[model samples]
Target: MADDRKVALDAALKKIEKNFGKGSIMKLGEKADQKISTIPSGSLALDVA
Candidate 1:
């Protein structure tokens, strides 16, 4: 259902936010070498498979 999807999406967003909030700096893979000031603290800047 749409409502269920929305709730699930919200939960996912919260997880991503929490992960990014950890403030752990990481090196990019061979292909990627970009920088971002802030993320939600330790999450990836891009979508993973």
Candidate 2:
């Protein structure tokens, strides 16, 4: 799965660099895990599909 996903991400990153500029791609990787884990219990919807 990781190998397949890396191929997909490589394609995506090239598109990002072409359309949005190289800086955007760098910024996205730099901030990928910078989100807050502040989900409120009971306020989130579960997806089964």
Best-fitting candidate, measured by TM-score?
2
Give Cα-based local distance difference scores for all models: 0.59, 0.69
Measured against the true structure, the TM-scores of the candidates, in listed sequence, are 0.42, 0.47
Name the top lDDT candidate.
2
Clashes of each: 10, 0
What clash count does candidate 2 reach? 0
For residues 1-49, could you state the per-residue lDDT of candidate 1 as single tens digits? 9999989986776777688853333325534345756545455655331
10 residues in a row with least lDDT, candidate 1: 23-32
Off by over 4 Å in 2: 27-49
Residue 12, model 2: lDDT of 91
Candidate 2: tens digits of C-alpha lDDT, residues 8-33: 98899899989986656663437553
